[model samples]
Target: MATVNPPRGMRDFLPAEKARRERVLAVIRARYRAHGFDEIETPVMEEYSRLHAGIGGDNEKLAFNVLARGLDADAIRAAADDPAALTDLGLRYDLTVPLARFYASHRGELPGVFRAIQIAPVWRAERPQKGRYRQFVQCDIDIIGDATARAESELIAATLDTLDALGLEGGVVRVNDRRVLDWMLSSFGFAEDERPRVLITIDKLDKIGADGVVRELADRGAATEAVEAFGAFLRRPSSADVPFGEQQIRGALPDGVPDEIVAHLTGIGDAVAAARPGESGIPVVFDPFLVRGMGYYTGTIFELAHPSVGYSLGGGGRYDGMIGRFLGQDVPAVGFSIGFERIVDLLEGEADAVDRAIVLVHDRDVTVAELVAVKADLVAGGARVRLEQRPKNLKPLLERAVADGYTGFAFVAAGSAPADIEVKPLA
Candidate 1:
C-alpha cells in the first residue's frame, strides 16, 4: 500500500478554502478592472524554444518541459541524456513571458497601449519550501506600448489600491531602474559585461549584507576598483533617517545620477502619491540597489513590500525588448504582479457572506422537488442555500456548514412552504 497525497509542492483546497481563494481573486480582478485593465488569458504551455528564450533570466532553468508525444524507449535512448532534445513545449514559469508571446500573436487586434489583466498559475520545477511551491498563481496587470513613467505609476497606484482592498495595510512599492543601475555601475568603473553578473550578486544584498556582497564580488574576480567603490556606496552613512523624497533618492545613490533618470523616478513617485493623498505620505520609496531578478527588465523595476513581511509581496518591471523576440520589433511594456500565494497567506480567511448563507436542514423523507423548490426560492431572493438531510447528530452537520460559511439554518418539513420557513442565525 502507498500513501496518497497531492503532488509535492502543490495543494488541494477544500470547498471552504477554495471559496476563500476565489473571494480573494475576485477582489483582485475587480480592482484591476476598475483601474481599466481588461482581462486576457494565455495557454499554460508554450513552445520549448520560446520558454527557453533568454528573456526569462534564471527561471528558464526551472521550466517544466513536456516530453514529446509518441516517444518510445528507442527515441528516449537515442537522445542520450539531453532533456531539451526531447521536448517541444514547456509550462510557463511566469505570466510575463506568455504575455509577450500573446501580444505578438494578437497585436493587430489590441489597442496601441493595451492594458491587460492576467491571473493564472505558472509552474516551476523547484524544491518545495514553506512558502515556495512548484505551481502557484500570479495575478498580473500589464500595460503594453507605453514607454513613459505613466505606465509604472499606474501599476504602482493600482497595486496599492488592490492591497488596500485585500485589507493588507502598510504596503509600499520599492522602486529602481535598470538604466540607473547600469549608469551607477559604469560610474564606479565596472565594465559593461561585468554588470549583469554583478547585478545578480547585488540582488542578494538583502540576504547577504554589504560585507558579504563585497566578499562575494571580490571572490568572483570583479574589478577591485569597481568592487571597492560599490562596496563603499552600500555602506554609506544613513539617509535612513531622512524622509523618502527626491532629496533622499539623491542621497541614497552617488552624485551625478543622470537628471532624466531622477526625474522619471520622481514623476512616478509624485503621481502615485497624488493619487493616494490619504496615506501617511508617499507609498513609493527609492532603493538604489533594487535589482529585480528578471533580465528582461529593461528600465524601471519595482517590488511590493508590506511592513509585516520579510519578503516581497509581488514584483514586475518594464520589459521593453521581450516582445521583439517574436514580433520582429520591440514594443514598450511594463507590468506589476501580485504574489497571490504569499498575499493570501498574509490575510485571514473571509466568508463570502454570513447570515445570507443559509443551510436547510430537512427530514430525509422530504420530497426532492419540495426541498429544491424552497432552496431555489431563497437563492432567487438573494441568499446562498444548501440542502442537508437532518442527521442523527445535528452538531457535526451544523458545524461543517458553519465552516463552509453558512451562518444561519432553517428547518424544513415535508410540507414546509417557502414563506413558512423561519431562518435562524446559527451563530
Candidate 2:
C-alpha cells in the first residue's frame, strides 16, 4: 500500500486540533454577532483574476493556482509540459477579494452599512515554517460604506477585546493610516508611484529592524537622505507622547506637507486615543513608521500581532474604491482579517477544552447499551464521545485513546453483573 500524507504546509487537523479551532472560532463568531455583524461566507476557490487583481504587492507570489481535476491520461499527458494552459481557477488567496466582488454584485441587497464576519480557510504558497502555513484560516470582519474614524477606532477596540476574550496576552493593535505613511514617504521625496514599494519594505520593519529597512530602501534606488529621514520617522515618537509622558522627538512637523494627510492623521490619532483610554497598557499611538504594505488600503490601516509570535496575526484598512473596480462606483469600506493559525498558536496553551475520547468496550452485542449510556452521559457532561473495540488488557486501548486526543479517558465495560463502575485516571 502506498503511504498517504497531507500536502506540504498543511496538516490533518486531528480531533483535538479541530475542537480547539472550533472553540476559538465560536467565540469570535459570537463576539462579532454581539456587535451586530452578520455572518458571511465566500467560496474557497475563486477565479485567478478576481483573487490577484490589485490585492497588494507580493501577494501574487503566494497564490496557488488550481488545475482541472478528473482528466483522463491523454489530457494529462498533453498538458504535462505546460500547466498554466491546463486551468484557470485557483484556491482563494484570502477572504477579502471575494468580499469585494460580493459587495459589488449585491450592494443593493445589503444594508446601508453592510457589516459581516467571514470565517474560512485561505490558501497561500509561502514557505511553511514554524507558525507559518501555506493553508490556514482567516477570520475577517468588514463594514462597507462607513468612513467614520470611530469605525476604525471600534475595529481596534474589537481586535483588542477579541484577543483578550481568547485569553491571549501581550498583543498590540499597531495602527497607521495609509495617508500618514504616504505623507511621510512623500516628505522623504518618494513619488506617488514608488510609495507601494516603500510601504512594503516598511511593513517588514518589525522583523527587519531600522538598518535592514534602510538597506531595502537604498536597494530600491532611494536617496541616502530619504533612507535616513524614513528611518527617523519610524523612530520618531508620536504627538501623543506629550500627554502620555514619552519623549517627544520631532513632534514639530516639517514645512511643505499636504494638509489633508496631516489632518487625517491627527483625527485618526484622536480617535485612537479615545478608543484606548489613559494608561490602558494597550495604547494605540501614532507611529508614522507603521506602514501596512497592502496597496488596496486607501485610508486608515491597522495590524494586530502577538508580541510572542513575532509576525503579524492579521490586518486590514479602508479601501473606499476597491468595490468600484467591479461595480464602477465607489463603495466606501473598511475591514480587517484575523489570521486563524497565528491566533491558534498564541492561544494554544489556554485552549484546553478540545477533543476528548470515549473508549467503548464491545464485549458482545448486549454490552453496547452500557457503552451507549456512558457515551451519552459523557456528552451530556460537555465532553465528546467515541466507541472503542474491546480486547482485555486495555493498555494498548488506553494508549491509542491518548494518541487520538482523549483528554479524559473513559473505559466502558460490560456491566449489570455488578453495576460497579471504575474510573481509572490515565497517567
Which predicted model would earn the best TM-score?
Answer: 1
> How far does residue 106 in candidate 2 sit from its true spot (Å)?
1.7
lDDT of model 1 at position 380: 94
Stretches of model 2 off by over 4 angstroms after superposition: 1-3, 68-86, 204-216, 223-282, 354-362, 377-383, 402-427
Off by over 4 Å in 1: 1-3, 350-355
Error of 1 at 405 (Å): 1.5
Q: Model 1: which ten-residue window has the lowest total lDDT?
A: 346-355
Across residues 383-411, which tens digit of lDDT does each residue of candidate 2 receive?
66667676678789878766656655544
- My TM-score estimates for the predictions, one after another, are 0.97, 0.82
Q: Scored by Cα lDDT, where does model 2 land? A: 0.71
Alpha carbon lDDT of each predicted model? 0.90, 0.71
TM-score of 1: 0.97
Per-residue lDDT of candidate 1, residues 1-427 (tens digit):
7658988989999887788888899999999999999999999999999999888989999999999998998999988688778999999999999999999989999999999999999999989999999999999999999999899999999999999998887799999999999999999999998898899899899899999999999999999999999888888877555555678778888899888888889999889988998877898888889998888898999999999888999999999999999988999999999999988888765425433899999998789888988999999999999989999999999999988888799999998888989999886
